[model samples]
Target: MPISRLSDLSDRALAPRLVIKVGSALLVGKEGARRRWLTALVAEIAEARARGQDVIVVSSGAIALGAATLGLEKGGRGSLADAQAAAAVGQIALSGLWAELLGSHGLTAAQMLLTLDDLEDRRRYLNVTATLTRLLDAGAVPVINENDSVATQEIRFGDNDRLAARVAQAAQASAVLLLSDIDGLYDRHPKEPGAQMIPVVEGVTREVHAMASTESNSGMGSGGMVSKLQAAEIAELAGICLVIGNGQHERPVARIIGEGIGTLFLPRRSASARKAWLGGRLRLKGSIHVDAGAAVALRRGSSLLAKGVTGVEGHFDRGDPVAIVDAEARVVAHGLSEYHAGECAAIRGLHSSEQAEVLGYSPRSSVVHRDQLVLK
Candidate 1:
């Protein structure tokens, strides 16, 4: 991918659906919820739906609203317990607001609060994906937010930018529009002299990351430019285009689609939802190293077998994400392991016919099925 101008989303049949991320700052301010802006935003969403586009909103105002109601605030953050309590309180208010606004346009709202595990664990990830597809089928716009009430640091996404990207991948959205306070990433901080906004980012490079990371979020928002870039990576892996733009304008989304008033990140594209998930997610528990023959087999779309296994490194249970590396330590692919690390270790280099005797039970023949693997 190379940097270029934002394409006309309307003029192109780019994707069947879209995921829009609304930051906490965009949704709430010093006084209260920014209902007027939200109303306009959803109106555009309704307009998109009118054009036969499925839309999902990954919003981030629960903690801000909840914190204000409870009178405990650290720019919309508090102790984990307090934040959780605030989310429990604010989510109801948030849902009610979404209901009223979307209903006014004859659109229904469905609330979904998810934590990292919801997208990290394969089974739960599939469930979330199915539910999202069903919600769209029912003509309801799903308003999603991170499950702050029960999530700990250990399993949290830490920012909605990445969360929104994950949602886009899960929903197989055509594109993602991240509504940020600033118009888009600049050559430098917008404050410095001669700072010009970069309209399109072909890819997130190390230099690009350092350029925007100096800036910080305001009010209750948590994500800054760096997180948005992180989101960009996820979008690229999913082969979904992403845009970061200022949402503080009238019919902001419309202008973004019509005039391209932001930075657009292009993508390479995904083969399927399953491959996207397997390739895009960040957490990997361990690695399975194989010989050159195994690597060739995998490239030819063969499932990983015990006969090719050399060794296993790291602690992982079945269904965990593990890197499949060749003898030279180059990662050739990523996959969900059929057997636990221990089971895999025990059956290494053994024939399928002899595996049951070693393990004392019948196991799946393939260590990593072709369907579960995504080549790098």
Candidate 2:
């Protein structure tokens, strides 16, 4: 395909759900969190939220901020120990800033720290997705970062770019905007004379990979241009549009989409790789007790329908993780509950057709979807 122009985007529409990745290089400065930029970015996000669009931010900078707080060199992960300490110190400040910034726009911010293990483990990935769904349902913006303090090369994602892609896959988002210092992919080292910018990429080829600069332009960030391409590949496989854009502007997302000031990687026309039997671990808040017949049904990989539940234990709200136990109160499985403890109690043993009358709302047929359950 030929290069796309800004005029081509005039009549275009963006995806309903968008995931934005903000690298540490763009978010942190000598003073710590760049409030001015963050304020600008969050303001735009608040506006999008107001317009009824869902947005999730995958951010980096905890370790950088922690290093700054500890008076260490900026972005200096001199040793594994040093990086972990910096992340521990920085996460507190990062979370606080995220809360304060989004709160100004009357938006609640929830923090999620993840590692590669969180995404790869069959039991934990589901929990993360469920939590994200819950937060979005509550109209809160989730600020996610790698759990750097506890992350090691063996378990860590290593960079936010690819993590953002994983998040988009789990969220089933339509678009991913990778905000960076540079505008987008280029034909050669941008500094080289006559180097040209590529406006749109339909595929990732060896030729495309060769275009990536070997060195990270931003000395502070772990993700270089290469990682952005890697992220694009992931997004493409999931049928999610990925854009690499300069985020220094007031409303970078708008500029990227509207002005064509970024490189847009088109997703495959058909995306089937996005679907998989995902696993995850989430904080457990309650338990659901079921009859022996229901236990047998669940053991056969059936969903926990409302009619099977004998009782609910503890006080878990919607989207909270709960144990599914048998008559002996032995845990059969762990899964996210579709309804709150009260709701589950109110509808226990009731058929799906009978739930709306008792609950005053149409209830999910299954208290726990089979896909969300992990058999013990």
Candidate 3:
């Protein structure tokens, strides 16, 4: 069902797992932390927890916080090394403050710093998701941030908005709320006269993207409205609803959730559809050719066991997506490989129990698990 009203969202039945993103501008000030705003935000989080919803926060502010602590001039372009050093210093203070503030509300906060590699690698992605799931189950609110200290331009996510979207996908969250400086997406730049707010977005069309082109002037944050729209697209494709709203007001989260004072992006696909989209989105790194019997087994929803694999083509690492082909060279499915191409080649046509003898140690019985496979 398409959610067109805020009343649909306030039901709580619609969103069980929620991921909220807080930009640096909302969390930091010229002097230091924004205590009153932080308190209200944490209070809202506590209220949500009391209502039995699992909430995760994706926060950004390390660089800005670090720069302030080091007495570095703000709004100045700095080198990558300088930014990294600031992040290293800021992460400690940022996480500490999060812990302290959440603690005051009697909620435990678990800090998680992640890099792009963590999500791109299947094994690492699973590990991160599992850890987050465990933390939520233990009643701990996981506060995640990008690992800016070690990230280079080539490896960084660039903004917490996209990171939050990826986290929503990995955690299988129901919704993602991006709290920024503006109340919501506007048809024109909000500062411009005659700008109109877009209350609901059923899908992120090219037209919707045009509204976000105005670069954000928020001194403490890197992302503008463009990044939030990008995140909305990601979240929508992952079967998660996304909301972009202002965080400067008291009880900002509550206002967004209860009053729906933001631009809401609805999920257009179902969970299975989203998974199929993901399976098809990645470029195939290699091919695993299987025998006739194995192909039939696959059709019957069986895992791709090592004994069934006849050949491994291309050099690819574990967790890389690979096409599963039949002997006729027809691709049947695609999935993340459990072993490197070289290791898979060595284990081809061997029984599951014989894997240890062939490779000295076997990581998994199946080359590609059924759960990971998406049939054409």
Measured against the true structure, the TM-scores of the candidates, in listed sequence, are 0.80, 0.70, 0.74
True-structure lDDT of candidate 3: 0.82
Shift of residue 40 alpha carbon in model 2, Å: 0.7
CA lDDT, every model vs. true structure: 0.86, 0.81, 0.82
**In model 3, which runs have C-alpha deviations exceeding 4 angstroms?**
1-4, 7-10, 75-77, 271-376
Backbone clash count, each prediction separately: 0, 10, 0
Instruction: Please tell me which model should have the higher TM-score, number 2 or number 3.
Output: 3
Model 1: per-residue Cα lDDT at residue 79: 81
Off by over 4 Å in 1: 1-7, 287-314, 323-333, 337-372
Error of 3 at 209 (Å): 1.5
Clashing pairs in 1: none
Residue lDDT tens for model 2, 49-116: 87777889999999999999897764659888889999999999999999999999899999999988
Which numbered prediction scores highest in TM-score against the true structure?
Answer: 1
Better of 1 and 2 by lDDT: 1
Instruction: List the candidate numbers ranked by lDDT, top first.
Output: 1, 3, 2
